[model samples]
Target: MAADDNENWEDRPLIMPFCGQSCWLVYQTLERALGRSVIIEPGLSWTLVRRQDPNMEHLAKITKCNTMVVLAEKLIEESFDPIVDRHTRNNMIQSVVYNCGSNFPRTNFSRFYTAILENDGRVISAASLRIPSPEIAEIPFIATSEAWRRKGMCRKLLEAIESALGDIGIKRIVIPSSTEMLAKWQIKFGFVNVDYQTNKNIKELNTLMFLKTTRLQKVINPITRKTADLNFLPPSSPRLPPAPPSGQ
Candidate 1:
């Protein structure tokens, strides 16, 4: 249907950067344009996580892999274009990067990483890493500039993030991405796919993929006590009546 027709479709589907059409201008515009009403439906995204990959096997072979790390705050401005440019040309990467940037909500910008490799103490490649959320720290991004893809640069960077996270007591991670190539790499790295995709989407334009790398231990306890937990109650306070009905 036409873009403007989205408003009337109360059944309008949830799109990315937004949970529902209630907050999406484009969806509203489309509904208006097509004269189709919208109906709010149930579809929301889920948070996922996993531990970072250490890449011990590859790091052992490299002689001069100096790990100089850059955290999320450091690489916030740099786009994911370099790697995207390699897979898809610079133009497509630019377009996709721009689209992805503009579409995602500002709040989802928390976890991110970029790494630089040093060989014999010299910089080797442009690297970028990211963790989507604090709760689901399972998967991270390790992107090496096109020139450094096959030279074990990515593996080194992965090891760096892996070590960093482990030092901080983060044992699991979850990556929210999906592609045939990525799937293959994940398999090689021993990432077990949880295979759970959320109801969240960017309208009909895109679908998010969730791959679980680490499963955290969940503790379940039975709740036999029914009294409302006083833990949520306020401190004891005596309330006085309204001044004897205003001095009646």
Candidate 2:
């Protein structure tokens, strides 16, 4: 399992359904390693609205900003660094939001998951899932607070988002991930390198690597058909099942 944004997660842990004591311990381990206070809560719309102070402008910004079309506006405002950042991972969420929001309008902002925990009334160490296209939700970002680095928080958070996605009838997931860690996760999660590209001068920017969701893919079944050779088949015959042989 992995973590995604929605740190203000509800009173639920996003770990695999069958995850056991060891997994729970991992969460604690991460907390201890980061040495930052963390709480996982659901990213409720009402909660986000209430969290946004009475600054009408900021609310409007959230409402009108093209970037806010998805759920990562808050993260972007918090300032994102693509390099040396494990929690935030790459700016995958930002890139997905920017790309889609740049083309779509703000009112179309649909429901998505972001795992966030309130720290002294300031939301921090967040991650988000973009359902721009339902069948293929994109994990754009999964970041932990600077003080919260080296903790297993990010992975735990992603598991939470995946649970939400499953409940919502989503399947076939995709994540924009770093190339270096790609191999590590591939070994860990069975992901494969489908494609790769790059940009020079960009530090730690993942030019390539995508993590596919096996859980999500299982929800879909492929349609199959059998083809017959025209020359081998009897002319003008319907492709029907053969009749059973006479009983002895």
Model 2 residue 164 distance off true place after TM-score fit, in angstroms? 0.7
Each prediction's RMSD over C-alphas, in Å, is 19.9, 21.0
Q: Give the Å shift of residue 175 in candidate 2.
A: 1.2
lDDT of 1 at 229: 18
Off by over 4 Å in 1: 1-111, 120-127, 130-135, 138-141, 176-178, 195-248
lDDT of 1: 0.31
User: Tens digit of lDDT per residue, candidate 1, span 18-122?
Assistant: 322222332222122121111111221111111123456544212112123322212322434233233324332223212224324331222222334434433
Question: Alpha carbon lDDT of residue 150, candidate 2?
Answer: 64
